[model samples]
Target chain A: MRTKNQKIRDFVLSAISVIVLIALWCAVSTSKPDFFPTPMATIERLVKLFEKPIMKVSIWGHIFASLKRVLFAIGASIIIGVGLGLIMGWNKKVRAAIYPIIMTLRPIPPIAWIPLIILLFGVGEFPKVLLVFIGSVFPILLNTISAVSMVDDMYLKVGKVYKANTWQTLHHIVFPASMPTILAGIKIAISSGWMVVVAAEMLASKSGLGFLITRGRDSYDVALIMVAMILIGIVGAALSIVFSFIERRLCGWMSS
Target chain B: MASKDIKVQVNHLTKKFGDLLVLDDISFNINKGEFVCIVGPTGCGKTTFLNLLTRLIEPTSGEILIDGKPADPHVHNISFVFQEPSAFPWLTAQQNIEYGLKIKKKSSEEIKSQVDKIIGLLGLEKFRNAYPHEMSVSMEQRVVIGRAFALNPDLLLMDEPYGQMDIKMRYYLEDEVIRLWKATGSTVLFITHNLEEAVYLAERVLILSNKPAKIKAEKKVDLPRPRSVSDDKFVEIRKDITDMIKWW
Candidate 1:
């Protein structure tokens, strides 16, 4: 009962805060052109963005462009991370060779490699995707490795007692056992990837939400910039919600 | 050849971790369908002895022969229930019980019948589809026990499986284990530090010494089925065993 009441109370407070912020904006601004755009102006600008083309692409096109890069990079990183991390965690020979290289590269920030990335790959979708991949891959890879290595000894004993062969143990025991931690890593990777794509776009792209934000800045359209920022925040929130739903579905056994 | 009734022969078994001897030249024979308990002090390498039986780790310098030959996991159908919660968290009660049958490549029909029987026997019908995290600890352990018994193993080794539970749960699970053991008639090597637990479950109890564990004493529990703790013989035997061991 308390939790239910708390949830309702929190929702109400959040709505109130947003209303107050909007009211403050309207109160502070005049009908004439001003430094800060009111909520009404921001809404009008957002509606206009959907109605007409900006920078030769519709609003949906720009959103899709950003979404595509983040999704593609995150997807590729999950595949690579699972593959390499499992190999590293299981096979000693590959682990010895590949483990140190990853450890060395892991501490280096993905954004720091932007200059080199742009120099090597050129300012294109590939560079932005690569940046997001670098930003996201570590959490997934490291968590997968930890998950595999850290499987409880008791479970392995159970496997041995049940006469599970090497492959059977890996398939039935290790993989499913690694899932909860891997999902947690995926959650981290996704948010990190989303943040990286915007920065990557701001640095390189000619189109995207980040590019749209930069365009707003270049044109000195405060309402346009506000629209882009609001869109980024909303999309970020939506991505988080979607990922949480996926996590609950995949690791239902862990739900409590 | 040894008699057909003998399931396992541990001849002069010993294990060493570096120079320190853990188990010192212990030998025993478990009959084909006997329930035997190995009782020892805490940290007395009882689990180590169980490990040797399972062949999870190699003995430093001895052999454990089953069926008058080498005991290898691949050749024998062995199952275990550890003290810790070893139920696969990803699987439901029913699925966890079916795991071994699937690994042994039993037919779908065999798997279904065996799983259904065990679930019914354990009274887990209501929670058969529940995952490990959803059930109480005792219920989860029951699921683990069911998983082990589903295989109907030639040898079932349980290492202090009820040691972590409360007294009520411990007694309840022990009764459940005994019921399963009686039903399956499987050879069980149960290890425990609890004297009452050993007395309650085992047909015969083998008590081990402190470190470099050796069979210090062996007592046949002649009490009736579902023996009461307050019964004269049960209490006497429990007291006798307690007096024999220098647990600390």
Candidate 2:
């Protein structure tokens, strides 16, 4: 429940967005009717979409498929990326040995792997998951490496003076101190994974929200395409919001 | 190990930064339970002298002895407080104060008791749970000093610990340092650019010359306890040190 002032503020902001969006739709629809849909028509089509079967092969199905692929990719990236990042950051010898390989591989786009991915993993979940992992892993690895390496030397000295062993120093000081930047990287990873998974699914998978959008485009159902697009936007926004909330709570001490 | 025993002895300590000789064959002995201040001009390498004593940086040549043996920073039991309070951002005041003891592997009971004593001693009970960001600059510095003192080190090395403070806060913290020094009876070697601060706190004031920094002058400040800046002899010693520093 919002207070009266809060309600007013929200309504005003929402109204401003609606007005701007309507003006944009009007301009685009008039200028290029074939490529654009009016605001009212899009809303009516969206309502028709919600009225369809809510159970099997519905929005829930697309949502679940997309979410499952995203989670798998994120999990894999965290495991491999954080492990490699820790090694590279903590050990100079390891950093020297592996950094060149990482730098060389990091430049290739995740989407550019579509042809290779289809050849290797076929038109299945594996390709989409792998693409998402590729999208998410580099930022997490780089951020973690930089964050851990940049911890103040004084703190390390203090730990040594107290006779803290190697494991103790890493666990108690290094990990906690570098967590803010790591969490920011995690937020970026999740959002990027979602985006990359959608593109990967459209190119490979037979099912999922991305498939729905591609199929709708083929069949000339603009309403279905618009609905899928809106779902993507909403999910992306929600994921970013959730990650930001977690980041704020986890790194709250820094603000104080 | 100190038991009404020897303090610090730096023997033939020659520290060079590449080709530049910072501390050239320097040697000094500090007695147990003494407050000694080193004063020098802006670029005289007073900071380098303290860093050698603290073993933050290894001396380019020669060695340091605490209680007539080689100094091990880990076991020699010296706590350093830098000019700026460097409380870890993530830890609250209570946690920061207890960090050294926790690192030394003290039992929880010991940590609690020591933290409680220092919090009360420094009048920091109100902000006990506050993080460094939440406290004023002076309060943050107070916590830094309190934390160092809680270690109960045999020797306390401070590098211009109150240099970043306002005049009023500086005096108040100086008095606190004096009070803590008297209470613990730990040997303290303080470095400062402020001539008045050096004269105010130390039994002996050692002044260093410009780069290739060596001891240019030394004065024994024989003032009584609870000395005031307004006192005639105190002002006189401060002026003499000021003049010596100007000469450099």
Writing each residue's lDDT as its tens digit, candidate 1 over A1-256 gives 4698899999999999999988887887655445778888999999999998787899889889999999999999999998788878777798888888999998888889999998998997788999999999999999999998998887877888888988899889988999989889999999899888888888777778898888888899888888888888899889999999998998899856
Candidate 2 residue pairs in clash (backbone atoms < 3 Å): none
- Model 1 residue runs over 4 Å out of place are A23-35, A91-93, B222-224, B230-248
Residue A229, model 2: Cα distance from true site in angstroms: 0.6
For candidate 1, write residues B111-209 as lDDT tens digits: 999999899889899998899999888888889999999999989988888878999888888888888888888899999888888999999999899
After superposition, the stretches of candidate 2 with alpha carbons farther than 4 Å from their true spots are: A1-14, A26-55, A152-174, B1-4, B236-246
lDDT of candidate 2 over B31-74, digit per residue (tens) = 88889898877877777777777776899988989887788876
TM of each candidate vs. truth: 0.91, 0.87
Q: What C-alpha lDDT does candidate 1 achieve relative to the native structure?
A: 0.89
Model 2 shows how many backbone clashes? 0
Residue A209, candidate 2: how far off, in angstroms? Answer: 1.9
- Which lDDT values do the candidates have, in the order given? 0.89, 0.83
Residue B100 shift from truth in candidate 2, angstroms = 2.1
Per-prediction DockQ comes to: 0.76, 0.39
The per-prediction tally of clashing pairs is 0, 0
